[model samples]
Target chain A: MVRPVNPPASWWRSGLAVLVVLGMLPVIGNIFRNDSSVSRCEWDGQVMRPEAAVTLELAGRSVTCCDVRCARNWLASHSERPTLIQVRDEHGGDPIDSADAFFVRSAVVTNRANGNRWHVFGDRETALRHARESRGRLMRGDEHPFAGVRGLE
Target chain B: MIVNAYAILSLFVCGLQCAVAVWLTGRWLNSRRAWSSGWTDDGAEVVERNAYLMMTLALVLLGLDLASWPLLYLLLQSYVPSWPGVMCIDGVTRIGTGSLGASRFLPGLLVTLQVFKPLVMLIGGAWLVIYLANRATSKAPLMRRLLWGLLLIGVTSLCDGVCTAGYLLIPKQEDHLAAGCCTQVTSTTTTRSSEPLLAGVSGTELTVVFMLLWAGLLFLLLDSIRKQRSGRKWMGGLLAITLVVAVLGGLFLVDVLSPALLQRPHHCPYDLVSELPESVIGIVLFMAGSFWVAAGAIASFCADVPETREILPGLQARVLFLGLFSYLGSFSLLSVQWCVL
Candidate 1:
């Protein structure tokens, strides 16, 4: 049987050099993928999560969380509280005042934009039913303890 | 019909494919004419020269064929991040159609180009297979059968490519076309339950299934090597199985790999390459590795058969090794990114 010919030493050297170049690529990519000036999640400064998008009116400007769960993290970084916060309902996809929405805190269903597994439903029955089926914790949006607790009050 | 560098290169490849078909046919006719006239001096050397020329031309076509997929992907992706869901060539045509406002010429032409691209890619693979077979052994009968097969594929591929030239020549301008993202392609955002692979299985289970499938393909290939005398039929069976595995791997890549790279649930293959250099590297390797698996299987399908039986085992083993290593290396990279990296 004719054995397969082995590639030479220079092949290894060139291969190693190519890997080195490839290794540096992630560092360059990190720089490009991350930008300080773009409006991003206050929690991570990354782009807003599309499905988990929660917009808050706060301090004469808009504050957004890539994930609704990031709302707390954003609040912790700021002293002033938001006057209004709106979260989209998972079932209906209509934006509802966060104070009025029911939230199911679970890992069963995930928001696509942000990696948060929690989903918000517009009503208590639906939220509780989801929790029953998916083994999630049913709670009011304010129960998650964002500054919007005052809004619910 | 946006005539960019990729479009021009595709046209050139189409021309090259046609030229090769003509050349091969011409060579066959000349050989037959010479054979009927009885023995001729310098025939062997002339045949040798022709083989070298064909080898060079086949390699060039194969390179173009392999590159065309990624090239088409890259050209269209450059429009994305601004315009999403334009992953397929036809989706790009949709964008053009939207921009031109009720014009059939652009979309009609681009869609035709899309149809031809895959046909040509299939023929290109056949060309590579035939070239490899010719060099593998001096079995004229099998080569004759394979060449006939190539002729059918080549005629269709060439005709399809030629049909798109009129559409490609039109100048297309990019405009305010709000091409949909994956969300639009999919009716709802939470349609995961509808996916065939994920229908009854959890994501973790799907991952395990894919790993086992890949391992099984490797095991089968190794076993085929061990039983070389009886392996030819088994290799054909294995090829059918590997093709299934490759298709499943592609689905998994679309469903899981893209999302893993993005660190999010909703994912696009085009976006994976555009967003991360690592993703592009990993996916390119994965695809190339899988192709090699299919190609190597095809090349060795009839290796254990009589006539060329003595000459094919070594070639099969070598090609299989290339396929195996490529797949292993690519998946290893993917695994790292998924879990650790």
Candidate 2:
């Protein structure tokens, strides 16, 4: 018959307890570090600057994009039409409803990921002024960058 | 074949494991033969020596193999810079798809390795625990059983070594292909594939289901601990529950937590890991919890053998406690993150 031996020592149990406790230290530390202050683009996963951000309401959630191109591409892919589309004026940094905004596809790139050079302004005069200085053309209503995009139309 | 420090180290580890596994196989056969035939006085000493050597080597190799799983990902991550349009480890796996050569098979080989490595690690870890428990006894009555288990582990390790070598040595067409990154792959597939699993279940509803499964798992684990033994039926039920919980946990991470943490609307775990490294802790906790629960179930099952019955209960209780602690820790961490978000 096989004899039963005494139970093993408790060292491993203590070691495991220590490990479980140690695993929580980093998690505790992460709680204090806030990352929400910087807004990120939903389409390309890039940080969105206030001047270059394109915001839209899709499926009851606010979606932010790095530029007009990303916003258009995102809209083109999704079947649901956005309820609202808003862009920031390049000069004044004020939110402008995309319907009333003037677009300028300049040589200046706003987001490097997609090489998006499209700029938006709240008024036609500012758009024309920047277009002349940057040697760019002002886009008309039909020629707007997001004209063909499903939700933006 | 993009050569780097990580690749070189991985190849070296695999090679060493292969060699050790071969040596272990020889010792296992010898030990089995001696045990079955009933060794004489001097032969018994040799058998004992061989058993000790085999156990020591197997333990070390298993430990190394466990560590290699994470190292495999890190190695793939290192290759990202060499492959154009590859933003993360997901793209690195698709590095050589355009080529019509052995490199085209790289992704398949890596995927096989990914699946095989976890199975090998889980079995190897369970074997290690059993061996430790048996070793604590005087006569080591479980030696015969352990020898067979060791042989099984050895064969798997050898196969794993071969697969790892194949994955590393194959030359990848890095620059020409410019494989699509996670943005293209994960964005389209995650939502579509998860929809079937969700079955019209929203994220909030899934969270409730996940929490309920966790609660059930906790109850089963605590009951097992209280009884000081797990019935076979309960063990199977526990494993099933653990599997569902793990799957739902992964879905939760991909669909909800990852996007929320990254502040993006897409589902990509690679981005989450790359962007927020601390999230790895919660993942580790979840994985560890799952492993311990499985280990405890295996321990309880092993108690069926007459010789191990006396000692395995204590081991089972300890492992179950670990499982409970790990699961609770993971849940708490996720809760904290949800609150913060």
Candidate 3:
């Protein structure tokens, strides 16, 4: 077993250890909560974690998502504390809390740029209100739906 | 192909080697003190034994690593026989791409490992000199011993720092700001207004400055040898001769080989044989410098004649000083200049 060479908790070593712990905060938060709704509203490489596969427990059912963005979308309707989540969000230093969010629902012209088909709602209303505002429109019947598992209890 | 892995491993081992050398030096001093007194213990003896074992291990590791190039060639012949697989001595790619600092593209992850190889060599060289200097004290004068010890520390550090910086600054392969070693002449639209003196200078000037410093050190080494006892002068003289030969070899390549042999007919538009080849002059200078360094290194390690004690230390110190000057100076000279019309 290796012991510390100069072992009275060397100030330099302690400082370095603290710095490393602080650096790990974002990464740990990401694994606990999928901040997808906020991410979709601000989609400029700041949105979802790139190509991350996550399993989130919403309400009583288990939902598997391609990424944090998908997880956030499913979590809006299904009321539950997210278990095993991944947070991908708000890169422009914008604080994207669930409260005080704007919702805009229009047939967003799908193009190569802004590639992900996301239900963006982080403007003027909470996510739930935004979902209700869009009720029974292009987002109605599941025809060619977003490529992911949906509606976890 | 897998040179990156080899380089990283070598660097890690080099750190271990440096630590071992320091430990051994401490142990040797302790043992000498014990032996001087009447009381003696097996502990000192054990330390001495361990030191020698460590030294031997370090040498064997270096030798094995150096042998890898040949070993790869042999393996290739037995396995997938291809034209490219067979390594050519002349066209062998210089280690590490220099794109880390020189270009828009992100440097390859593996290229970073290239910086460590030269560092390992510098440490290894210094370690060898120190080990030899310790053993040669009986035959060397005080000055000679001191010089060797000083040189070992100074030269190694200089080489390590300079080579690291050069590889980072000057891309090994052809870059957009293409300078060192790659100059293709295309057009000859000579601008008459450019500073004539600065115009002649190129990236190769670093090599020239290095060569000049080395030559000066070589001369000092020769004078030190001349002062040594009658029989020991021959060793110093021989070393001086070897130094001269090596310098000449480098000069011949830079001056005669590159211009007379390597230069092809006009291909690129920017090409112009504007002043006498500055690179050739630089090569000759560096060659002279390398010769002196090698000579000093050998003499410090080998000579132990009765009257040469003082001379050994001085020679060692000169070697160390010159080694550093050449290594860093060469890189600096190359970094600041480039191919132009």
List the global CA lDDT of all models. Answer: 0.57, 0.73, 0.38
**Ten contiguous residues minimizing lDDT sum, candidate 3 chain A:** A39-48
Top DockQ prediction, candidate number: 2
Q: Residues B40-129, candidate 2: write the lDDT tens digits.
A: 876687678898899887887787677778778888878867743555665677665545567767878888887778777667757766
Q: Rank the candidates by lDDT, best first.
A: 2, 1, 3
For candidate 1, write residues B201-276 as lDDT tens digits.
5667777788798889878765544444225466677778777777778778766776666543343454555555
Backbone clashes in model 1, listed as residue pairs: A49-A66
lDDT of 1 by residue, A1-153 (tens): 854433334544664555455445555556666644444554433465455678878768877776676676566546667788888888757888877888787757363333466778888889899988887897644466453545435
Question: What is chain B's TM-score across the candidates, in the order shown?
Answer: 0.69, 0.86, 0.36
Of models 2 and 3, which has the larger TM-score? 2
Ranking according to DockQ, highest score first = 2, 1, 3
Q: Model 1: which docking level applies?
A: incorrect
Instruction: Compute DockQ for each candidate against the true complex.
Output: 0.07, 0.21, 0.01
Model 3 chain B poorest 10 in a row by lDDT? B265-274
Better of 1 and 3 by lDDT: 1
